[model samples]
Target: MDALSLLANPTLRDIGAGAILVLVVLMIITGRLIPKATHDREMKTAITRGDEWKQTAEETVKVNAEVLSQNSQLIKANEVVEAFLRSAGPSPADTSPVGGP
Candidate 1:
C-alpha cells in the first residue's frame, strides 16, 4: 500500500506509537544517566586538577612571599643608602666641572 495507507492501518500505527514511546523512554533514561555519569567524571577530574592547582597556588604564594621579603630587604637597603647620602652632604662630584674639550 501507499505510505499514508500503511500509516492509517491501526496495527502499524500502534506499533509505530509503541516504538516512539520506547524511544522516548530510552531517551529520558539516557538523558538522566549520561549527564550524571558525565558530571561525576568531570567532578573527579576537577578534584584532581583542583589539588594540583592548589599546590601550584601555594607554591606561587610562597615564591611571592620570598620575593616580597627580598624586596623589603632591598627597600631597607635603599633607605640606608639614602640616609647615608643625605648625611654625607653634597659630594665633590656635585661641584666638579666637566673636562673642557
Candidate 2:
C-alpha cells in the first residue's frame, strides 16, 4: 500500500536483490582500477624526479670541469712569468764593481 509495504512485497524483493548485486560488482571493479591508476601516477612522478636529478648532476660536473681548466691555465701563466723574472734578475758577476776596487 505504502512505500515500505511495496518494498516488502515479494515481487519487489527480486528488484532490490538485483540492485544490490550491481552495486557489489561496481565496487569490486572500481576497487581494482583505482589503485592501478594511482600506482601509475606515482611511478611517473618518480621517473620525472630521477631525470631532473641526473640533469642537475651533469650540470654540476660541467661547471667543476670549467673551473679546473681555468685554474690550470692560471698556474701555467704564473710559472711562465716566474721564469721570465728569474732570467731578467742581476747576475752574481754583475754585483761586483766593474773596475777592481
Candidate 3:
C-alpha cells in the first residue's frame, strides 16, 4: 500500500515515539528548574560580597576616626609641654672650645 507496507518491524515506531517523549519530558523539567536555581545562588553570592564590602567600609571609617582623635590629642599634649618649657625659662651656656674661622 503506502510506506507502512515497507516496514522491517512495526515495533520500531513505538520505541522511537517513547524515546522522543522521554527526551521532551526531561528537557521541560530541567528547563523549568535549573536556571532559577542557578540565578538564586548567584544572587546570594553577590549579596554576601556586598555585605563584606559594607563591613570593610565601616571598619575603615572607624579606624580613620580613631587615628584622627589620637593625632588631635598628641597635638594638644605637645602644645602643653611647650608652654611649660617656655614658662620654665632658658639659661644654658655651652663651654665647648670653638673653631677659628
Show model 3 residue runs off by greater than 4 Å.
1-34, 89-101
Q: Which model scores highest in lDDT?
A: 2
- lDDT by residue (1-101, candidate 2, tens digit) is 79999888987787776797888789778774356878899899999999999999999999999999999999999999999988986675676675655
Flag the better candidate by TM-score, 1 or 2: 1
* Residue pairs with clashing backbones, model 2: none
Candidate 3, residue 97: the lDDT equals 52
Provide the TM-score for each candidate, comma-separated. Answer: 0.53, 0.50, 0.52
State candidate 2's TM-score.
Answer: 0.50
Which residue pairs show backbone clashes in model 1? none
Candidate 3 is scored at a TM of 0.52
Error in Å for residue 79 of model 1: 1.2
The residue-level lDDT of candidate 3 at 54 comes to 100
RMSD of each: 9.2, 13.1, 11.5
Alpha-carbon error at 78 in model 3, in Å?
0.7
